[model samples]
Target chain A: MHETALTQNLINIACRALEGKGVTKVNSVTLCVGALSGVLYDAMEFAFDAMKQGTVLETADLDFEELPVTARCRDCAYEYNPVGFPYICPVCGGRYFEIIGGEEVYIKNIDCIGDDDVVTD
Target chain B: MSQIKVNTDLKALNNEIAAQNKEKLHSCGILTVDVLGSPGSGKTTLLENILPELAAKCRVAVIEGDLATENDARRIEKTGVKAVQINTNGGCHLDAKMIERQFEKIDLENTDVLVIENVGNLVCPVSFALGEDLRIVVLSTAEGEDKPLKYPTAMLKTDAVVVSKTDIAEYVCVSTDKLIGNIGTVNPDVKIFTAGKTDGEYRAEGLVEYILEARKNLK
Candidate 1:
């Protein structure tokens, strides 16, 4: 559900970014999906596929760089990926950790197929 | 075409709005907290009990979120407080924009504390920031002890966890110790409190005090 809003934001970003570049079409758009962000990649892709219709991203490929969940323990400053279910910091056995990574959802880059850029077959 | 490098965070716009909300709320000196839980988790019950106590200390207001009903707001209004309900209409969670719209309707200047009771669900609300200074996740004994493990995000992101409906702990098979322990395993720093039907009296003393403290120490 939220992915719909996110996908719409992505399209808006792409369109605005496309300005002044003379980009005719967007070939593909890459995204960095964080594991801890709680966004289901498949759902987001599904949303992008459905909602991008008739928009600037109509023909653009939606790609993801699925990142790993990482956390830093505030107690001992220990950082590690939770291997088990508890999500505890392995070093300090502390569950309270400041999530440093794996919660970021961002655009990496947009592949624009302009009149003068490299053409994709 | 040309490769136009553009890096944008999907949460950038939302987070920006949330930040703006935070600034607006802060400028008004309103300490807002987002209270979240499951559908039947007794989140509203906890608020029903605590709102009066909170009102006794400071000017308290509530922004209740639901799928399509103003029922929760009606319930909170019975306590003689200003409560505005935002119907998501089918949305899973309440976002910053929803809260922003209520700024005018909520009587911001006179309010010392604003409690945003988010759409009752365990998942989506954890990901959406509603410009709340603190996040509280309420879980009742009836919901079982596996909530923290099953939906860890809600527990992990909250500043406090309220174990509501403790009076009926005997009826439910879930152990209070086990529930709190599981919550600890998820987020050790979260302040935990037992609310509702404690020792034959409905009380959320610790919960009320915690919110007041949070309000007093607002950033």
Candidate 2:
């Protein structure tokens, strides 16, 4: 899986967050990437290997929550998931449907030892 | 015996940076214009005509992103504005971090407009957001009418579209109506600007007018 720059960007951002809060060893990593966000999960993991090398986020477990494309029809207010590309409402077949969600790319939380841990030389 | 729950996703960090970049641009009262298109789309010609005029009215600057070379930046600087060349060195797109770093190198406090000439690719540039207020997609008449429909991502993300090389539209067999129709299918509201660099009867003038209008709207 060749990581796109987008995934690498996410990894770089995560690394900064980890370092900022003094997260030496991350217990788990969870992300919510929307279908429309155009983020590839496999590529993200591929980038994590090289991007996190020699960093505090070296061995963090990367978890991803894939978001589906949900749309609300403008004509009939019908909400539904996209069956395929060229997203259109199934019930009303509305050409224009506002994107309600599934573009989220953020961390919910992290388990890390706050600086009050064992002494380090 | 204890249990810990750590849910850290690094992607949020980039998103935060993107937000911060947007906030900075917003506070400056400047509109970050992202110019995206395929190779040889006459993006340079459009800028060459518009930048000097825009700079005369308001403080303007450019952040040029490309696979390599300062060619586009060099071209824009001739119009008498600070053009910072960001050579991506084969990268397909420009991300928020790249734009954020460019901000440090240039001053946008008094600047009224920030034009980002993104790498010439119709696909990848749409995937990355550089915190721009508006994304402009340029297509030359020489590129054909089916361009927008084939590269839907670029059209979908664009706030405006410019059909360049309009003077050569007849020779190239590029139908203006068909091109507009394709763009309309994807983005019905996007303003379309027809432009070129022919001496007297050029459409470049109208394009500059649109840029001015965009500036006023951003303000």
Candidate 3:
């Protein structure tokens, strides 16, 4: 539902990072999306396609690398990927655990053409 | 083409602003709570019931977020505590920048506890940190027992859960116990509270007590 807003932020951040770097055109934007990030890839792609128009990312491809949810059992200090609801530790059967990863979306990198590569019209 | 390794969190700006809000609130010795839930989940009712008790002990203020309308702010104002309304104008969630703007309107030094009623939502609000000391998610019995499982991110991020409208559980054929069990499944460390009528009297004693205790412990 908020993919459009998120996509806008993605564009803004990418543009800000490229400021004064003499970048000519953005080729692709890569993101690291987590399983628990609650972002729908299809929605993100759709929003990116629509909002990237007339922007630095007009021709950029949206790429994603998914990260799995990982947790650490507090009782026994065991680390594992939670399988389903009622996430009990497989090793120690402890229910108490802390989520350690897979809950964030990060912009990994951007592929761009430098100003030096631009052909004179 | 060259790849620039930007490697930045999408929510970095919001988180940074949230951290600043946290420090500002902390310096003022104010305890802030962010309340999140779906529309019609009894978030306002829960606050209306608890605010009076809370106000009696300390100076309390409310920041209400909604898609449109000052109705909630008006409701909170009826309780005699000051309320600032922020209409998101169709935005799904309230971000840290919005809260930072409210600091100008609210007298933070005079307020001991600041309760922010987030725009009613189960999903979008889960991702944005509002610089709250405690984050609470309210779930009504009418919403059913599977919400915690279906919206694990909301359950995972909240510090506590309030199972509201227990008074209608029987009619709605909802089991509060099952709801709580599901909540525990997703977040084993989260505190849980229930609020509703019991024996013709509306009650949210546990939740009220919890809030007071949380504030006390903050000092």
Candidate 4:
């Protein structure tokens, strides 16, 4: 029940999509998460399992697309992806940079079952 | 059968809360700074010493996150400023939702500086974001010089590193030089400071000055 709120939100969104599309059950839910998003995948999964127990997504699968942290240099305007922490500009060696990409955590898509067949929504 | 359709990202709710908190902080031009460190690393002591110095110049608000006890909050309140203690119960790190809730209780407009003291753990706290202007990690000499290398994540994400307990550096075999070198290896640009006891009082002028200078740089 710790992630009840989060789980409720997830189920609400997923259930709506399922019913709207005339799908009887939701097979899985997919998400795209950036490395810098600061989300605990394990915790989210645990919360999902606990939260979806009695809902329409009781047995839905959760998929994740992990993205890396990418930034652009302020000095040279060079763009690059940072592998680990202590981000620096790859081109100009400038410490100052803007995070132009990564840090994305969103619902990329979902999968559902319509009538008696599997479908992607 | 009528079908009901809804397309929503569940995480959006949390993100919305985070955005509101960000806007509130932005309107006031106040920067939220997070202080992270391991247990027994002299984090509270460093803050206690610097609070009065910083508070004298600007209105500072503190959000202290701990597994238990409001003791740190009490200590910070003695500085004659606003302090809120967030008890995480058993959570290892302080998440944005918790901070978003805390932001509601503080008047961000009057606050010039906001300091969030993260739960005492180098590993977990590094992975969690609390929307801070700068993330400073505190390491004490007693914790050994290899701490930065051992807990590379904390050092890697930090904008600065504070080496505390320099007052007893000679008594302990902690290689301050080696520690600085290792820290530079992981994060070359991270501002480093050493706070130790000098003469009759603890001298942390460098660290204090860094904070003051940082506040001026904030937009």
Question: Which parts of model 4 are misplaced by more than 4 Å?
Answer: A1-19, A33-47, A69-106, A115-121, B1-15, B103-109, B127-131, B142-153, B168-173
**Which portions of model 2 miss their true places by more than 4 Å?**
A9-35, A38-68, A74-77, A81-95, A101-121, B1-11, B170-173, B197-201
Which 10 residues in a row give candidate 1 chain B its minimum summed lDDT? B1-10
Model 4, B3-107: lDDT tens digits are 233335455765566566667787898877889999888888888888898899888999999999999999989878789999999877787789988877898
TM-score of each: 0.93, 0.73, 0.95, 0.75
Candidate 2 clash pair list: A14-B10, A109-B7, A110-B6, A110-B7, A111-B6
DockQ of 3: 0.51
Q: Which ten residues in a row have the lowest lDDT in candidate 4 chain B?
A: B1-10
For each candidate, report what fraction of the true interface contacts it reproduces.
0.70, 0.23, 0.69, 0.17
Query: What digit string (tens of lDDT, one per residue) describes model 3 on residues A2-121?
Result: 777788889898888777778877889999998888899999999999988988789899999998888889999899998787788899999888899888898988888886653221
lDDT by residue (tens digit), candidate 1, B56-114? 99999999999998899999999988899899888989999888888889778898999
lDDT (10s digit) by residue, model 1, range A1-121: 5787777788788778776666778888889987777888888889989988987788988888888878888789987877546677778777667878877888888888776675332
Q: What's the C-alpha lDDT at position A120 in model 1? A: 30
True lDDT of residue B154, candidate 3: 92
lDDT of 1 at A98: 84
- A25-121: candidate 4 lDDT, tens digit per residue: 6667776666655566887888888878877788678877787767777789998997654567777778766667665556666666667554443
Could you tell me the lDDT of residue A74 within candidate 1?
79
* Candidate that beats the other on lDDT, 3 or 4, i.e. the better one: 3
Model 1 DockQ vs. reference: 0.54
Tens digits of lDDT, candidate 2, A36-103: 56566776777766676776667776777787767777789898877544566788777776667665
